[model samples]
Target: MHFSRVPVRTLDTDEKSVAQFGTEKMLESAVLLADSDLDAVVTLSEEITKATGLPCSTSTLAQVEVLKKYGVKRLSLTGPYVDGPMRGLVAFYQGLGYEVLKTSQMNERNNVVFGNTPLVRIKELIREADHPDAECIVVACTNWPAALVVQEMEAELGKPIYDSVCVTLWKALGMVGVGIPLFGWGGLLQDDPILKKMEDVLEILLTCCAASRTTLRLDFLQKNCHVDTVCAEACAAGIAQLKQILVQNDLANTDIPPPKALMDVYAVRAQMLAPLVRGDEIYGWISVHQVGKTRVWTEDEIGELREAVERVNGILRTAGWI
Candidate 1:
């Protein structure tokens, strides 16, 4: 798919002194553009999400994608916005379970100044925002020329640096199942298999570990149920399975004989469950199985499964899901 830029004039020349894009107007522009030229629309501005009362940085779809991909619960944020909007941006991420360990804003309102800020200043701001508990650093504005310095900054800081524009492109490409190689942008790009796997695992988490049977029951009791019965039952079952695995910590047919009840429920002769864990904490669990015949899980297969689960834990910790 070809990439296109749809210029949104947020303000006229006379209105340039203040940021003037209302949420209704911005959504209207996005809807109009999606109708005319794109399969999907990813807004680059964080302000829109903030103004729209979204829990996270809804202004840009890329920010949400990045948070999901990394499972970032705690973050270090650096951006180019005024004090008020900057606080709103941090609060947005916080609402999604991300704890802002530190935040550094340039306090620059003019696009020209933000775009023209020196590379050294960018590095300094990121450094100021860095914290030991932060899982990743997010350079949070699309128009601040952050992509140009992302590679060097990530290397220097010894953590991933997610620039807004690069993340938008990454999500767009993935949406179309395109695996085009990209380099020097940041850890998110470079066509990294690990990053893609992390994204895949998070998708599984969102789909599989949705909610427990107890939660569904509560919803039904409160008359707040929105999910259909079939779907809700499925989610509850999947979550129950994951919780069972978490209590066991490790389970494999090769190591221990499968219980009759477990076998009956899954209808599987061979199965392995790996916990998504960091240190001593367990976030969730994932498993692989064979349906009919007994099969052995090889060393490589088990190792890969553990790695994927660990990756999920890392992302969840960073995104504040855990």
Candidate 2:
């Protein structure tokens, strides 16, 4: 595998500027990895993929995926960040349906100081952030050399350790279809059956829906969606419009008229959307779209979609993502 590194300026508080930096710097790579835990920077994976025609992974997304693979619901977080960014990380995890039981930070803003942090101090921060109930411990920030001590920390703490750098590499390698056995880093590098089960569930959804595309859009992560098929710009716009309509009508599903944008822009003739709800909260929705020609959704087809939702919800609950 070819490897290269391009460094950017420190993150801007403004998300637009961060996105611009990502799109500009992430070109000409077979697979892109945005090495930042900030939501603004990490959430640009989809956008970067669209622009560069390459798979993209971010530090935040990689951490989340690792947690999902482990079925980790509760997290303890530590990082070399000030209170604001630390809290942002907590919120980001909570928004994704993970319980952040505790957080510890260095309260440092200097990236140079972040990198200079001693391994002993890093271990202390991880211990301070750890909660008895937290299923996993996440050490955030790619600049810090946390990866060097993750395996040791995990052994000492007796739970999974996810350092930002390690998880990013794990996801990046998987994206490029390279399976090099990574050891002495963390448990995330190992194979797990849960990941395969999640893949199979999505595959079943596509076959049951009989639609051209199926997407799972989490409300908190509006810019990114887990899709069974790549959605073009027009299809993405249509899905956004459909989501808006679902909200406006206070409906559990989008069984209403096709969004004008779906028909006019994307030639999307038929669509079905169902909310993935766990009790009172609606975290996200599953959408199936049929393009080209309009077709009425049959009762059997709708039933099959609902059944798939139930099955997915069961899997999510088991995986601690709900």
Candidate 3:
């Protein structure tokens, strides 16, 4: 909850001097942090760790961890950074094998100017950097107050947004094993634990049903119905066909005739889908698939799937995600 500022004379300073300044500041703060008896220390910049050889969590590391957790390989980046730092950020992600679909920067080198940038302008920059193929958008610069706009932008864009300040706190909390359910900042802070529990439920359902695959599709924060978690093998084509059938059947729980193309292309023989409904609204559905050969769904299997749906709905309700 406490912050210590390390004043950099200029962001455009030579790299060596900047690194030296970071190292000195980290060394000075390490003593204070250790004396304060904090559970963990989170640095806003990765340079502190690189310069001081400290074992603290950092924003850069947290952002990468979150991207990996979300299975994001392609991203669009926006920040209040000049060309040099912007290119370096792009290269850093590229070195990690992530595809940088687009990048936008404010070209501002002054730290104060970066902090004083308007929130509306930051949102505009993020939107400009976004691409249809990009899995997520990254808002860099811990000083820019990007955290305040992450939730609003994610809802507007229908994709996750990772901001530096939020991710740094996320990493720090996780390191200390604090399971605080957070909301409103971004999906990383809000939905990570919920998603983890949903995935666990899918694994249990997969084992209990003795099926080839089990998937949990939910209408997440943006009300977009997508596969949120899967257990065992997943067939994209099979899931797509199942979705079509569900739409055609009016979201009812039924064993519809499998389309010939589905069988021919993906070898999906049978599927049992139960809609996750709480009263009038149909949030999404849980599906169990039988591949390679046709098998009639037993009453017990259908019953198990229905129970799983109820469990998922309970989770969604408990997390206030419904």
Best by TM-score: 3
Give lDDT tens digits, candidate 1, residues 101-179.
Answer: 9999887767667778888888888898899888898888767788888877775676788888788778766655666
Candidate 3 lDDT by residue in tens digits, 1-322: 5566666544653685367456567767755665565666777345545544445777888999999988999999999887777888899999999999999888887877888889999999999999999999998888898898887787578788899998888888787876554655766775555666876777777777777677766655353334442311232222332221231121123346655665676566667777777668766777777666566666676777777777777877897876
> Which pairs in model 1 have colliding backbones?
49-59, 70-315, 71-315, 71-319, 72-318, 72-319, 72-320, 73-318, 73-319, 73-320
Model 2 reaches what TM-score against the true structure?
Answer: 0.51
Q: What's model 1's lDDT at 157? A: 71
Better by TM-score, candidate 3 or 1: 3
Mark the regions of model 3 whose C-alpha exceeds 4 Å error after superposition.
13-21, 44-55, 192-322
| Winner by lDDT | 3
TM for every model, in the order presented, reads: 0.50, 0.51, 0.60
Provide the overall lDDT of each model, using Cα atoms, as 2-decimal numbers: 0.57, 0.65, 0.71
RMSD of each: 16.7, 20.6, 11.1
Please provide, for model 2 over 167-209, each residue's C-alpha lDDT reduced to its tens digit, 9 standing for 90 to 100.
8888777776656334456656643344345445556665765
Return the TM-score for candidate 1, rounded to 2 decimals: 0.50
Candidate 1 wrong stretches, greater than 4 Å: 1-19, 27-37, 44-59, 194-322
